[model samples]
Target: MRKILVVGAGQSGLQLALGLQAHGYEVTLMSNRTADEIRYGRVMSTQCMFHTALQHERDLGLNFWESQAPRMAGIGVSVSGPGAERLVDWVGRLDGYAQSVDQRVKMAGWLDTFAQRGGQLVIHGAAVSDLDYFARVYDLVLVAAGKGELVSMFARDAARSPFTRPQRSLAAAYVHGLGPRPEHPDTEVARCNLVPGVGELLVTSTLTTSGRADLLFWEGVPGGPVDVFQGVTDPAEHLALTLDLMERFVPWEHARTSRVELTDAGGVLVGRYTPVVRQPVAHLPGGGLAFGVADVVVTNDPLTGQGANTASKCAAAYLRAILDHGDAEFDEAWMRRTFERFWAQTAGPATKWTNVMLGEPPEHVLTLIGAAGALPRVADRFANGFDDPADFENYFFEAEKTEAYLSEVAGG
Candidate 1:
């Protein structure tokens, strides 16, 4: 049996472990978490897993679909500005629905399933202080730790990347009692409030089976003294300021606290972490035969909501490379294929999306909006991002497409 050790119990790690064990490898999944340690609490910000990801789960025979994951038909985007609300209904539909299960459920499910498949799950309290041990014991060690401290082992500093510039900062809070749903028919919708010369704020209403709706607010600002986490000194002051800001500019879907009957205190706020977008590094540390995988090495900004999806894709690609090479001479071939495939297939798209979010809205956005409203086919392609890479790729470069669509609107 070929022994392989996977660190981290997140989605990417579980997916990689599951993929490897299924191929008859002796896999040991280690994390500092026990089954009971898993929490069912809701994540601060709800993210949409693209249809492609859902379809991938189905293809792997995972039961994500039967779990009541909502299939979002299209996105109803409302751009509020000085004039009025320019609402454009983009009729995009997914082949499979993007499920909004919290990261906890998603990770726990994958880990539990892996255990059932004869994979070992170790709940060790100590960190893996030495990679040398894994080098001696297993044929390989895969680090899917996301953005944990373990990344420092193999992180490539800014000096390495071609586009080595700092990333935009973000502040996100998960709040309850936001309000009732918008009158729009689609789920997974986002409202972009453009603040003329300052910056833009994008708010999305999270779709949960629970009556409680998840409210997410994202804003862009100059690299000065901006608190990315609603960083007010007093809790009372923070809640009041947030409520006031939402009412004045970003009209939330529903009431702030009146609608939900949750017992949690109104002052309970989930603030976002500082947004320091770094060039994700993946060089082999220790000069060993092993390498890092996915976000542990490279991470895209959450604005694109592509981090989990990108990590999963990388896991899939790495698994294939490992299986193809088998046990003998595995390390060298794996690293070469891993970096090559990631840079070629995924890196370009991730970078494109990140840059778009950081920069100002292009004129093409207006054009694409009008075109998508008039054409449902174009809209459908826009929504099925997880399954259709081509469509997903187009969404990142929407500025160009928007211009073309605008010309059509003008001619008509």
Candidate 2:
């Protein structure tokens, strides 16, 4: 059996490791975090898996949903502007899955499954100091390290970038004591509130064993005063100010509870460095010493609330590529094929959706919206794109749909 070493055993890391093992590869995962450390804690940030990504969980046959699973029948979108409010509710069902999953449970469950299947898990704090040694020992060195120092090596060359600027930084916090309104049980169903001028924010009901329900808030405050994130001496005052501002400028209509108990005691701050990398490194030679793999690739902004979903899809795509290639020489052809598959399957939609949420909507977004509003079935598919990635390439980007939507928009 080909032995694979997966670094940074977080959400994406655990998914890739488990997928590889299930496909008959011998996988060993190493992370600085121990199981004990992982269990008693919530993850670094709030993550909600899209319904389709939940399908990814099912495809792997992982049973993380048995004891606790959150359900979303459909999504509600509230778009507000100065002195105006528009509420669009799409009651179409989720087809076959939950719209979101708690990352803490998902990772913990994944780690447990990896161990149960005879895969090795190590809790050593010793970082991989030598990529050369790693490449020699493992058939493949998969870096699932999130946005960390390891990503520096795989930075995309500036000349190849397609975008003029990097992604704007985001600050998010997850907390409990915020519950959805009883009438909007369906609203607990993932929803995105587009506060055009201020910023876009995603609020959802998190599923967890902890009786305390959690609400996540993410904002894209460009050049705002909250730059010195963790440096703030009084987080309570900061949170109060943020809440006050949110109440003043934005219409968070559905959320019944606005006051949140921030669980991030360390005063974590979310800020993005521009240029989110249109092209991430596909392979690293010598496991990184001679060449490095594109591990910490950040595709979509948190504004769209698709980051975790996109990451899961990419993880699945990468696993398929590795399994198809087997232990054969990791050649350029293999790398190209894998990268192409990911670009088409994951990155394409992520970039498109990010642009839409972040003010660079494709010409088709308006058309698609108009069509959907006029036709429920069409709207269902358009809204469902959040869960089904294939829609990215198949429906919205389809030539016929594009032309029709463009024509309709022009006529109006």
Candidate 3:
């Protein structure tokens, strides 16, 4: 049996480790926090798994919260002007729904499940120097940790990375007492309110550490009005500041959150990171190589909410590559090839679409959004792109492609 060490317990690390174990591989999964700690710890991410990613989880028997998590049937986009007046508002329906399970809930449950499946679980922090020691024991080491000094092992790929700094100042909090969806009171949707030149606000129904609640996310343009949560630690205080920002920029959301309260004491998170793509092969001190996965290789701004979805796809792709290699040397060449396959199929398009959304959108892209407001097919296509970003390459990314597609829709 080939022994594999997977560091980090986020979506990629746990999913890949569990998949390899199920396939009868010798897998050791390491996490900084244990299952119990993760369950009761602060929230990690606003993780909404779209249809494709959800199917990947189901195939691996990892869809533990499907029945309990709130279902998001569509995406509602409200673009407002400086004065908080809505310029265009529409809800784009998706063929299949998406679901958000708080990482605190999802990751903790997954950690327990991984241990039950006969995989070795190590709970501790790992440093880059630690990789030098681990490189000698395991046949192959995969680094999935998105943060910490260990991540510095992978060098940034300047050619592929477009941004040198964070595109948005991000702040998120899980809260209870949010009012019903204004458009369809009974149904939940991923509501995004964009205030051009200022920032964006996203509100979605999600399963929290406690239970179902709303996730309020603010993405402020650097140095903008909504970029005010630098030192806020209390969840209640975070909610208060978030509510104030919403009231001034997105009144509709403010109305919904007027009576909102924190889901728990540790339900808030505030931070910022520059989106980047790093070289997949990291050279250890002892001249050994470790492969990067998920955010370790390709980190994108959460403006498009693609972080968790991308991580799921990366795990699935890497798992297939490992199974196909079948006792072959897991050398530096194989590591690069594996990441290349995943990058070509999944990561490339996702990064392009996310970067496009972050910057000022082109005229043709704006036109498509306007068309989607009136046409159900256009709206559905746009919303479904979140599930498979590769779909954007056909009609949404390039100016000429979008214009040509829109003309055909109009003619039809």
Candidate 4:
């Protein structure tokens, strides 16, 4: 049996460890916190898994909260115009529904599930020096943890990474009492509101540790008026600031948040990270090599809301690569090739889309979003791109292509 050490208990690490265990491999997972600790800890991310990413979990029998989570049927986009006016508003349908299960709920449950399967779980913080020793015992040592000393092991790929600093200051609050959107009172979808120079506000219903809740996320352009979360540690203050931004920029969204209250003391979060792509293989001091996975290798801005989606696909891809290798040496060469294959298929497209969205929308991109308001055909395709971003390559980048495609839509 191939012994593998997966350091990190996140979406990618846990999924890969569980998948390997199901196949009868010896897998040991090292996490800084236990299941209970994570469940009671502060919220981690604002994630909604679309169809393709969700299927990866379903295939592994890891969709424990599927039925309880909110069904985000589609995506609604509202661009804030001059003072409470919506310059453009439209809801695009997704072929298959998307769902958001709070990481506190999903990760905590997954941690317990992994242990119940007889997989070895170590509760400890891993470091570079620790990996040097771990490298001697396991057939493979994979870094699933995206932060701390482990992340520094993988060097940044400068050629692939564009920004050296965070583009947006992020703040999220998970709470109860949010009223339903009157426009789609009967439907549940992620409503993305753009306030131009201010930033973006994304609201979605999710299943949390306590039960059903809503996530109010603000992605503010750094140094801008919307970047107001700095120095605000109190949860009430954080939420109040979030509401104020909504009222001033997107009253339509604020109307739904009037009755909002935090689900728990740990329901609010604030942080930011620069978008980057790192070298896939990390070299150990003892002549050993470790492989990077998911966010560890390619960290994109959450502007596109693809963090968890990318992690799910990355875990699945690495599992296949490892399984197909049989007893072959999991050497540096194999690791590089495996990550590159996944980068092309999933990471590349997501990173490209996210980086593009982090910047001001190009004239062609703006035109595409406007056209979607009047054209369901265009709207559906744009919304569905969140599920499979590769489709955007055909019409998203070049202005000429977008114009040509819209012209065809008119004629058709």
Candidate 5:
């Protein structure tokens, strides 16, 4: 059996490792923390898995929280002016529901399952030098660690990378006591409240360490008013500042979250990172090479909420490529081909859609959003784009295409 060494135990690494083990590959997975440590650790991300990504987990038999996690039926977008006046409000229903189970719960459960399935679980931080040693033993070494020193293994693809600095300062807190959506009282909706120049505030239902709760995520444009979480360590203090910022920029969300408090002391997290795309192949010292996957290669700003979904898709794509390669030697040519296949099929479209959302949205996009409010078909299509970003190429990405599509939708 082909032996594979996977560095990092995040969504991409664990999924690939577990899948390989199930397929009769000898898989060794390394994690910085054990299952219990991750279970009790600080919150990692605001991950919402759409239908396509969810299917990947189901195929691997890893959807452990499907029944308990809250179902996100649609997305509600509200744009506010400088004075906090709601300018445009629309709700777009998705064709299939999305779900967000806390990574702490999901990853911990997956780590345990990996061990149970006879996959080697090494609880240690894997470094570049360590990866070099592993490359000799394993047929293939894959780095899926989303952050830290392991990311530096890959060099940045400057030609494809768009930003040198972070687009937004991010702060998130998982909380309970959030009120229901005003439009759809019974259904849980992913709400995006955008303030054109300032930033965005997103509220979505998620399963936290304490069970189901709403995730209040803030993407503050650097140096803007909402970018005020520096030096804040306490979760309660972070929640207070978040509520204060919401009251100023998104009063409607503030009203719903006013009484909400952090689910635990470790429920809040604050940080910033540049959205970047790097070369998937990384050269290690001592003449070894390792392949980078998911966030390590293509990290996007979370404004579009595509991080976890993209990682899941990357794992699935890479898994397929590995399975198809059979007993072929995993040389540089094969590695490049494997990454190229995934880039063309999944990562490229996701990166484009995310970058478009981060930059100055064009007039056509604004018109499309406005049109979505009046047309349910338009709204449904727009909402489903999150599940399959490749669909954006048809109408959402280009100005001419979007205008023509909108005209056709209007029957004009």
Candidate 6:
């Protein structure tokens, strides 16, 4: 069995480690926190895993909460009007459902699961010196950690990463007692409320540590009015600010949030980060090579809701490459080539789509979304594009092509 040391315990790290273990490879997974600590920790990320990413989990028997978690059958887009008007409101069915399981809940469960299954796990904070020492012992050392002293080792790919600063201030809170959209009371769905100059709000249903709950997340344009959560450390205060903004800008959404409150004292989180893409391989002081995975290589803003999905896909891709390279040296060339293939096939489209959405969307893009309000086919196609973002490249980016595609859909 090939020996592998996978650092970090987030979506990508755990997934890759579990996958390799199942394949008879000797894998040691390292996590910075214990399962209990993560379980009770602050809410970390907002995710709505579309069909493909979810399948990667199910195939590994890692989807323990599927039936319990709310099935996101569709995605709705609401463009807020000045004050209370909803200028454009439409929801479209996804070809296959999506789901969000809180990372706090997920990572904790996966950690325990890995240990129960007899996989080697080290609950230690792996620094560069530690990883450099392990380099000689393991066949491969994969750095899957998204943050910390480790991630900075990977040099920024300046050409690939366009943003020098965070585009949005991110605030999120999980709560129970949040009501469903009155328009679609029976069906569970994820909603994106867009306020032209103020950034966007994403309301997603997720399974939390206590039980099923709703996640209200804001991606506020920096220095804009919505970017107001700087030092409010109290969870109650954070939630109040979230609801207050919702009432002012997206009253239609706020109307149902009367009963919403924090799921825990640590339920609310506030932070911001630049969307970046870094070189795939990092060199250590001892001449050891560490292969970067997922967010370590490519980080996109949450505006597109692709972070967890991209991580899932990246882990799978790296797993496939590692399996194919049986007993071969995991040289720098091999690492670069593996990442290049994944970038071209999967991450590139997701990154390009997200980067495009972060700026003032092109006129063609707005026209396409507006048309979806009237055309079910257009809406469904647009909704499914979140599952397979490459589809957008075919019909979304160009005005002339978008018109032709819409005409085709309308005629058909």
For all candidates, the clash counts are 12, 6, 0, 0, 0, 0
Candidate 1, superposed: residue stretches over 4 Å from native: 40-45, 83-91, 125-128, 157-182, 185-242, 252-258, 261-287, 385-412
List the lowest-lDDT window of 10 residues for candidate 3.
252-261
What is the Å distance of residue 376 in model 2 from its true position? Answer: 3.1
* lDDT tens digits by residue: candidate 3, 1-412: 9999999999999999999999989999999999999999988997777998898899999999999999999998889876898877888888889999998888999999988888899998998888899999999999999999888999999999989998999999899899986678988899889899999999889998788999999999999998899988767788889999999998977888757899989888899999999999999989988999999999999888899999999999999999999999899999998999899989998999999999998889878887888887888888899988889999997789988888888788
- Candidate 5 scores a C-alpha RMSD against the true structure in Å of 1.1
Q: TM per model?
A: 0.79, 0.81, 0.98, 0.99, 0.98, 0.99
Mark the regions of model 2 whose C-alpha exceeds 4 Å error after superposition.
Answer: 87-93, 124-128, 157-166, 179-187, 224-235, 252-255, 258-269, 278-295, 360-375, 389-412
lDDT of 1 by residue, 1-412 (tens): 8888888877678778888887888999887675545534434234556655555556667645345544454444545555334454344565655555545456666777888888888876324455656666777877777555666666454533334444434544445455534555335544444443434444444433342344444454545223334455554454455445555554543233444332223322333333222333333434444467776666655655666676667777777778777656655555766666775687556655555655666766555645666776555555454344444454547556555544554566
What lDDT score is found at residue 287 in candidate 2?
A: 39
**What's every prediction's RMSD, in angstroms?**
4.4, 4.1, 1.1, 0.7, 1.1, 0.9
What C-alpha lDDT does candidate 5 achieve relative to the native structure? 0.90
Tell me the RMSD of model 3 versus the true structure.
1.1
Mind giving the per-residue lDDT tens digits that candidate 5 earns over 81-154? Answer: 86899888888898889999989999999999999988899999988889888888889999999799988778
lDDT of 5 at 64: 91
Better of 1 and 5 by lDDT: 5
lDDT winner among the candidates? Answer: 4
Better of 2 and 6 by TM-score: 6
- Summarize candidate 4's per-residue lDDT along 89-108 as a digit string, tens digits: 99999999999998988899
Candidate 2: tens digits of C-alpha lDDT, residues 1-412: 8888887777678888888888888888877776656656644555666666766767888656734655555555555566645433343345654444556656776787888899899775424454446767876676677655556556574543445653454655555666564546434466666555556556666655453355546465465433324344465655565555556544453345555676555333455555355344433444342222223665455665667777777777887778777558765556556766776667666766566556645656555654554566665555576676556565565558677655665566
The Cα local distance difference test for each model comes to 0.56, 0.60, 0.91, 0.93, 0.90, 0.92
- Which pairs, if any, clash in model 6? none
Weakest 10 consecutive residues of candidate 4 by summed lDDT: 75-84
